[model samples]
Target: MTPDEFTATYREHYPRLVNLARRIVGDQATAEDVAQDAFVALLKATLHDEQTVPRFLSVAVKNRSRDVLRHRKVAHKYAPFETFGPLSAEYALSVALFIDIIAALRTLPASQRRAIVLRTYAGLSEAEIADRMGWARGTVKSHTARARASLRRELAEVA
Candidate 1:
């Protein structure tokens, strides 16, 4: 597609895309990143089937968000070695909280985590999520349900 077309598409879909990214990544800032990344990808995107532009964008945005979440999961998995050489007290406290939250999130299976993130963080409808994640709608629903149950079990002791 042309640059103008890409821009038009991005403007049209930006809000929903942000919502989708937010659900997948679990934060406003990260969601913005995902959405922005989608737009960037769209700018340079060249699909063999130009008719499916929207679908391509939807999948790209979701995949970007998933990548962000996967990165977080990986980071969380090895957080014990994270360091701030000149750490202030507040920084140390923040790092500790980050580690704890990551540890808790790690309790869930990958599918459940992605499902929860896509539903809650990205604010995507189940149908949209199913399309983006390339999963059956019912499977997405089941994963979210399981994620919620797992989250409850993990967070129950936190508070």
Candidate 2:
């Protein structure tokens, strides 16, 4: 594709691709980075068909998200002990609570987790989440509602 075509494609698809990556990776900043990287990779390649651009970008974003998740897993394995250094009692308690919430999020089923993350962290509306996840709008709402209830119960028990 030419530079203009590439620019147009990027503008059209960037937001949706970033949302897709965010669903996979669950972090907005990292998702943006992943989407940008995919576009950069597309620019570097020679492609004869503009029609394939969206599919190519979607696959690229998924691969990059997987790479990021793998790297995070490896990093967590060797994370430094001082990462959570001495803190005030209130600060420590808050940190513990945050950790607990993350753990609770992980325990949810994959659909529930993705729905909750997309809705809460990415701030996507139900219709947007439905489009990204290829689910009906009502399905997204149901998943999010169930996930929220489960989290509430789990956190309440912990408290």
Candidate 3:
């Protein structure tokens, strides 16, 4: 599709995506930022089809929410790497999953989580995320891969 079409899609879907992001990210400002960034990426995309729009949006929102969570965790100095041990395995797994998601997210150098969230949650095309992030598509793909791998490894160790 043409640039105009992309813009129109962004306009139509941005509010919905923002609402979704707000639910996960838990604030208005960060939600707006995530929505804006996602739509900006969508605006820059070559929308060869429209059927995948929902998927694209979901990924973007999820990715952005995760970013906000990571930022909040770091800004608050709530690092889980510090030993707070002696919890049981089940409780430990639950807590670790929560912390693991946060720690894995913090481990990302920003770009990786962007790619990971977009791909895994928002279901965005790598090309679209790359276009939005202004990186090569392959870079988007690898960042996603690494992010997933890291999360799995980190969570498993805690488990």
Best model number under TM-score: 2
Among all windows of 10 consecutive residues in model 2, the one with the lowest summed lDDT is 79-88
User: Between prediction 1 and prediction 3, which has the larger TM-score?
Assistant: 1
Displacement of residue 49 (Cα, Å) in model 1 is: 3.9
**N/CA/C clash count, model 3:** 3
Q: What is the TM-score of each candidate against the true structure?
A: 0.48, 0.53, 0.44
Instruction: Write candidate 1's Cα lDDT for 55-108 as tens digits.
Output: 877898889987887898888877775442467889888877677667777988
Tens-digit per-residue lDDT, 13-69, candidate 2: 999999999999999999999999999999887778878889999999999999999
lDDT of 3 by residue, 56-101 (tens): 8788779878988998878668657544556688986787577768
Ranking, TM-score, top scorer first: 2, 1, 3
Q: For candidate 2, list the clashing residue pairs, or say none.
A: none
User: Which is the leading candidate under lDDT?
Assistant: 2
Clashes of each: 8, 0, 3
